[model samples]
Target chain A: MTERLTLALDAMGGDHAPAMVVRGAEIARTRYPQVDFIFFGRESEISPLLDRMKKLKAVSRIVHTDEAVSSDDRPSVALRNRRSSSMRMALDSVKEGAAKATISAGNTGALMAMAKFVLKTLPGVDRPAIASFFPTLRGETVMLDLGANVQCDARNLVQFTVMGNAFARSVLGIKEPTYGLLNVGSEELKGHEILHEARQELSGLNLPGRFHGFVEGDDITKGTVDVVVTDGFTGNVALKTAEGTAKLYTEFLRGTFRSSLLASIGYLLARPAMRKLLKRVDPRRYNGAVFLGLNGITVKSHGGTDALGFAHAIGVAVDLARNGCLETMGRDFKAVDRSTPDEPAQAAAV
Target chain B: MTERLTLALDAMGGDHAPAMVVRGAEIARTRYPQVDFIFFGRESEISPLLDRMKKLKAVSRIVHTDEAVSSDDRPSVALRNRRSSSMRMALDSVKEGAAKATISAGNTGALMAMAKFVLKTLPGVDRPAIASFFPTLRGETVMLDLGANVQCDARNLVQFTVMGNAFARSVLGIKEPTYGLLNVGSEELKGHEILHEARQELSGLNLPGRFHGFVEGDDITKGTVDVVVTDGFTGNVALKTAEGTAKLYTEFLRGTFRSSLLASIGYLLARPAMRKLLKRVDPRRYNGAVFLGLNGITVKSHGGTDALGFAHAIGVAVDLARNGCLETMGRDFKAVDRSTPDEPAQAAAV
Candidate 1:
């Protein structure tokens, strides 16, 4: 366990926290013996699950964090006031060098605030961007700013492009990933002022082989572009909308199948294919978003997500921490890969 | 045959110019013979369709335009180049008072450009905004700037607010439509400067109703908020993403339904309900986007859409023209109702 990449799970984060969080960590420990883990939250709330996991040969330690951060509380205030909150303590482990990364299935704002405060921003990084692996109809696309800095400046967007590109290459096995700035139109005058300037910066970046031009929302599911960059606000909306619509549509099919006998039979026979399709679009498997620009690695899962989903996030944190992704991004930002298309479009504007 | 609303159709404007446009119009015409129409496009291309419609007891007229607008052309250039494009001629009718409102299934950019040129902007309005109606899970919600103006100033957002409130009232039948600015987060400081100012203005709009602070992207379907507002650039992306995802998800359902013999039987029994559900989410049915802020009525339909979809757009145009929506919005902007909760918030801003 000493040589393994250690993770601290925030047991009291997310809609189904402590219970699902403990279960997910337990599964990860048993599945990946090389991974070390610590569960942080109220002892009474976590002990039962810890006992069960220990019985299942999952982990060796669990720390009690009696305080909790409410989803509605202002992130900065919650982090500063709730000293023993699970989210804060998990983040503290990363700061104290006990854990290489932390996983939180709690309030995104609170997690981001705590991570930035405890772990601090990686050097030469303006902001820590959020990037996720999305299962698109056209294979998969690595997307950034899924809910980090929503109102992004030209510099913020540029940083997202750089970090996202590194993620696509290192984690997604993408080769010479194409970069796209999400805009309403593909024209030079298609987006807001920041987008306009981002285009100019990206053009001047002189990366090894960056893709040209803009992409729209449809492109995310279409795979016409590789690395999609957007402000966190729009990106969050796009992701959530996509998820909600997919769910509604799935319900429509279920109703159709249940309406009659023949349709029921057809649904049963086609069940495998339907399941495959569902698996393909499932966020759980693709459930990883590295909070880039953080000195220590951090990954945040959806608030209401289940165990399998949290495990997927852990997989991402493990890969990132193991590969020294933060260092790579730092190098990428510091002008190490000038010839690589993954570098910033312009020199850091700081 | 004379009872239904007579619509002016831009038959030569879309990607399937003249042909599919003619057939779609025929479908609409046949479905409602009382619905008369004016088809504008090349005489040669439209003549045969007119003859067929006449055989089907569907009355229709044709106006010949010598040119067409392509997808790639610039919006402004498309309008200037197509001096006699069918889309333009249809608008001419609306202007000359020949038609109540013009309906175009053409290059949306071209249709929007030509529409603004021929119809002109309303007083106190700098540009006409685009709006899309969604049969939301909660109710009908109007999402605007669904791709009209790319970049907007804080002032433009205010104008859009006034107009969207009007559109929601006119089309959705909501006495006081709730206004929400699209952003990453709901907090006042979550967006760009203009949006930040927009929040203050929105909070202070006093537009005869309530201003629901700010709403994020996923709120569009959650029924949490009513009227979603943004610049055309972002609005357009959001609209298309919703439409595209809707289509893809529905297709996934169809694939499930057709999977087996038993499912086929179930499909038969569910046919009625399935159609009802499809109708609930049909993008074509929710096709028209009113060009708000325009002095005269103009409606834009998806360029690749069918005639029935265009028919719906025609209906929207009729509704706006009849209701004098712009003037209604003007009044609301000038005065928020005393009983409305948002009145105080909008008082100083308006």
Candidate 2:
């Protein structure tokens, strides 16, 4: 039998907190029988919830922590004042090698700051990027630098590509995933100088995945590439815009069905098919946002997600740890020849 | 009767040029009988189409031009070599006061470069922005810097707010539109220093629209503000991403209906409601992307759009010109105190 994989959880992080966290762990336990969890939060709040989850309690250990990071805490403030916060303690477990991965649904900025401090960045990596999976026509595609490094240079973008490529392979199980740089237009001269420079550098490298050159924004949902690489600023905006649009589209659909009694009856007949469609595009299926380029595996769950969504985040951490994502990234980075990289540094500085 | 508004058209622009352009003009003539057109292209090709459209022929005059801007031409290359091109000639008509506005469905970069060179920017306006109307839950919202100025500072963004506010007032007929700066998060300390400074400056101004402070990406579709202001790069990415997401969502819906025979029958029963829904989200309804801050009004039609879409673009230009959008913007700019503007210039430079 394979050895059990341990994952650290910040039980007090998300909106629904101890209840959702405990229930999500229970659900995740059923899926990943060989995985154990180390919960960091107030035991008093978590113990009663754990009592309700017998299967999760069987393989769980709780570390009492009264202090927890508030959603409003700034990254700097959290780092200085909330050293013993649940989010920090969870990251600490990963740093101490007690857990293979850590999952948190805390204040994003504060979590990123703490994760960077506790786990540090991989060698030769300037900053860690937040990577997440997006549902596409061709199944799923991964995008990186969602909101991590806002103003990235060519070097930072290239690094993102490498990290994204590695994550797609390790987590998604893609044999040889293709990646593209997201830009305004597909033309070479369309975007700023930094994008052009990054494209040049990426094209010259004998990377693992095939670099599909430049891709426009529409290509993200078209599944034009396995991985879409962009700076944190644009990536974040695109992601949030897509989410808002999706919500708006669904609302419009609901309003259309409720417009008439006949349409409502028609909706009833299509309910089963609609359920399948909803499941296919469910946000919970794409909950976890992995912090790529970090020394240890770190996955950030959406703060407003429910138990099912939190469970999916746990699954993402488990998959990454089991697939040895960090080791794969290390190997990929070392394979790249950094002999003529002065251009990227100069471009990034701008 | 009101004076006729003449709009210059680059008949040779777009993929299905001359055909789509002439046909679109014919369609637009039916919508706005008071508008006349000065078509710039090969008279030999357009005369026949015009002959088929008697009403359009009555109000239109063809100005023959042998040259035209190619879709593949670089902006700088087109500006230098394509001086007598149809696109250039069309803009010339607006510059010479022959037409109140000009509309093109050619290369966006080339059109912007030529338009800027022909019509100087408004007073206190550093650059012109591409503004478009997006369908939202709260009807329609205007967004600027869609793909114009790639890198914008606090000052450029503030200027965008003024232009967008004017566009919403004059074109959209909103008495007091609410505007916001798009950012990664709604928190005051979320984005870069430029955003913070822009927010500070915007809050201090007694602008026409209510400044909604900071808004996240989702706020655009939620219609949290009447005018969504962002830099070109982020705005462009967000726009395309939303488009892609809409397409994906529609495809998912179609797939759902086809998944089962019962679902297909239900779709048939709800066909009328579905048609109404389709009409609401149709891209043709929002075809024109206005170039704001230019001395002369200019609208860019989607290059790949059909006659209906092209007609809508002409309608946008006509509305902007008839409503005196330029005058509104000029008045608003004059109202702002420019004495303490060193902060904006410094922020914009970075």
Candidate 3:
């Protein structure tokens, strides 16, 4: 018999918490049969839901924490007051080795703060970065620093590249993932001082993944590289912009299909094709945002995602733990010399 | 009779230049009979193309210049050596008051450098920014600093807000255009220090347009604000990401429809509806990117765009010149006090 892996769940997190979390756990239990869950939330609320899910109840145990972190709670406020909150307890489980990983759809800022505080950064990592995969023309590509560190220096970016590279290898199953620094243009002279310095260092790195030099915003969706590295601010903006544009185009198509009777009939015929297209670009399929460079595996689901989306988030956490992504990341970091290189004088001059 | 407005054109610029330039001019002539053109390039190449366009020949004058700026030339290199290039000569026409505006489908960096040198910035403006419109669910929204100033201070952002507001009013025809500063989040505590300071200054401005405070990246396509103000780096990345995402979705739809015979027939039935959707999101419809804050109205067309796209770019120049967008921008800048406010000590602390 295969050894069962334990996972931590923040049952009181997200928009439709407790119910969605319990249902999602039930679904995940069937999908990942070798996995067990430790639910952290109010026992009164979770016990009734667990009673309804027979399979989930057999493999899960409730921690019984009434305190929960609100979606609007500031990271600092949550950190100071919400020690017994579901989100914090979930992270504590990971830190204590009670769970291999933790999954939550809670306040992002608060989650990041508590996870960083409890789990700490991995050896040789200065900070943790939010990493997620998005659909592209060729396939899916992983992007990092979604909104963790707003203003990153050259060193921070280089570290993100290392973490993102490891992620693509372990999670995406790419033998030699190609990575690129996100910039205004691919030209050498373009972008700011930090980017130039980061480029120089990245170009010289001897790693499993190849650095493909600079890529623009469009390259993210074009699948120009396996990993796209950027500061938190630009990455966040670019990700959101892509989401908004996808929504806008989808709305336009819907409006066109409803304009006339003939068009409506056409839509009926094309419904199968449209469903395939929708499944390919569904946001729920890409729900989990992994906080890379952390010592423990922490996956964040979208606060507004549904039960299926939450189940997918749990799947991501299971995959990471099963594949030993944190161990692989640690090995990758150990391989690199983390000593800060002499800052290129020309970089400062620019 | 309406006073005729003249637009300078760089006939030797873009991927399919000289031919596309002349053909686009022909289309523009029929669209706006009141607009005249001065084509700058090698007369031998342009004259023959003009001969094929009879209507364009009647209203356009060709300037003889063998020198042309190559697409690969660096901005500084082009500025220093390509003095008599078609791009430079076209700007010279605007500088000499022979044309109200100039449009070119050429190297963006080279064009910006030449245009700035020739036309200079408006009285109270410190830098010129690239502004363009994108289709939104509500209608069309304007975004500025597409890729002009990479590293902008708080003051530059405030200036962009002023310029963007004026462009929306004069060109987009919005009387009281609402504007917002683009950020990672809408919260006051989010984003970098510069964004916070910029927000503070913009909130205090008693301008014609209402400041809608901070807006996230998704707001750009949702049409949350009429004008989205951002530093050039973020704006450019967001714009390109949207374009890339749109292409990705379109490709997915095409692939899905081609997967089976039934889907192919369904595509045929939906062709008319798809055509309508295509026309609405057609990139050619939004070809022009105006360089705001310049004394002259300068427009940049995508280098890879076809004749129709170039024609739309020319149309943008004509509209800006006819609406007195530059003059209105000048008045708006003059109305705002240019003095730097005392830096909030808290801004430095952050």
Candidate 4:
């Protein structure tokens, strides 16, 4: 049997919380029998859902908390006022060493703020960054700073690259993940001066991964690199734009299939093939975004995800814990130089 | 019969040069009989191609220029040298009032620089912006500042909105286009302070279009607004990312259809329907990107496009010139205040 581990979950977090959270845990428990859970939420709402899943109930415990972070609550307000909220309590469990990791599908900003405040940054890290993996042509590529810092300097970007390198290597199990700095163009002279500075620093790095220099937005889907690093603003926009384009493509295909009688019959014949296509690109399979560079593991599931999606998110947290992701990153951090690369006086010289 | 108009063509521009340029003009002439062309390039190369199309040759004139801007030339380098090159001479035709507009398929940076130098900005305009239209859920939407200015202040963005408004009204034929400032989120406090400042200034404007406030990257495909305005860096990245996503979708679909025998048969049966779908979203149909806010109209065709795509770009130039796009923008510029709005002392006040 595999070694047992405990994960603290924010039960009253998502859109269909408590029920979705409990059911998801039940599903996860089947795949990871040795894993236990500590659900943080209102006792009245969660206990009944746990009662329905006898197998999950056998391995789970509850930490009752009436307060919950709302989707509309500002990050600062939620952090300051909702100390006893389910999200906060779950994070606290990880901080206090009662749980190996924490998972939440609550307000993203609130979760990030609380996680940063509670768990704090790991050694030699300037700021924590959000990282997520998505399906790509070659396989999967991990991208960082999805919505964390709006504006980042060369030093911040270099730090993000380091964290992303660790995440891709440890959690994703790539022996030597390649890193790319996301920019408007792939040329050395293209984009802002900060990108150029970051490039200079990245080129001189002694990390295990190969620094791929600059990559354009399209390189993300092409799987040109194992890890993509960018500021939170551009990363968020690119992620959302890709999502929207996929939706548009689906809509177009649907309209085309329904436009004629022959097309309708063709759709029926291709239903199985279409199902395989849909499964390959299912958003549920890639539902978790982890806050990297934190003292402990914190995975944020999509807020509107169902049981299956939440279960996938739980799997992500389990994978990170089992793989000793924190330990891997910690060791890597110590080996690398932590000081910010001094800005070159003459940018044109680059 | 429509009033006759003349357009200058950079015959040596693009990957396929004089051959594609001449053929594209021939195709364009069929749709626009009232339009005439002045081809600028080596007479030896262009004259041979023009000789094949009698209809095009009847209404076309040639201006010999041995020098042509190479694809690898930097914008500043091309601007400083290459004065007598085909691309520069085409712009000069527009400046000298010999042609109503000019079109090119050369290096985008070179084209923008030459156009700005030769044509200059319209009265009260701070800088010229590159505007392009793409298919969306609801008809089409125009986006601007697509790599013309990488780093933009609030004042620059406000000017792009004004220029985009004029382009949609005149060229796209939208009576009152709705404008949206592209951002990471729709929330008032989501992005950089510059966005907030631009929003404040936009809200106070008495423009023709309705300001839809902030919009995310996904909104571009959703057709959430008629005009999406953003800084060149973000805009260029978002556009390329969307293109990459669309390509990825196509690849996945192709792989799915070939995975099984039944799927292959279904694809054959659905061929007609698929053709219809492809036509609706064909990149060729939306091949042109106009350099808005220039004193003279200039359209840039995709550098690697074929004759059909080049013709579509010519059509865009004709549409803009025939519709009096420059005159409309010039009139609007006169009515609007050109001064930058003072930056608010306290950002918290927004």
Count of residue pairs whose backbone atoms collide, per candidate: 26, 0, 0, 0
> Across residues A228-319, which tens digit of lDDT does each residue of candidate 2 receive?
99998888898899898888888898899998888888898888998898887788998999999989989999999999999999999998
What CAPRI grade goes to candidate 4? medium
Best by TM-score: 3
Model 1, A1-350: lDDT tens digits are 33666787888888888788877776676666788788888888778767765543354477876788888878778877887888888899989999888988877777888888888886656788788876566567888888888678987887788888777777666768888898885342467878889888887774434765688888777777779999887787787667666665666556666766755665566666667667755768877667887888889887778998888888888888777677767777777345535445555643
Q: How many clashing residue pairs are found in candidate 3?
A: 0
Candidate 2 collision pairs = none
Cα lDDT listed for each candidate: 0.74, 0.90, 0.90, 0.88
Candidate with maximal DockQ: 3
Error of 2 at B216 (Å): 1.2
Each candidate's TM vs. the true structure? 0.87, 0.95, 0.96, 0.95
Q: Where does candidate 4 stray beyond 4 Å?
A: A186-189, A338-350, B186-189, B338-350
Q: Is candidate 2 or candidate 3 better by TM-score?
A: 3
Candidate 1's docking class is: acceptable
DockQ of each model against the real complex? 0.37, 0.58, 0.60, 0.56
DockQ for the candidate 1 complex?
0.37
lDDT of 2: 0.90
Q: How far out, in Å, is residue B243 in model 1?
A: 2.8
- By descending TM-score, how would the candidates be arranged? 3, 2, 4, 1
Q: Candidate 1's residue-wise lDDT over B96-177, tens digit each?
A: 8777777776677777778788888866578778887765556668877777788788878888888888887876778877
DockQ preference between candidates 1 and 4, better one: 4
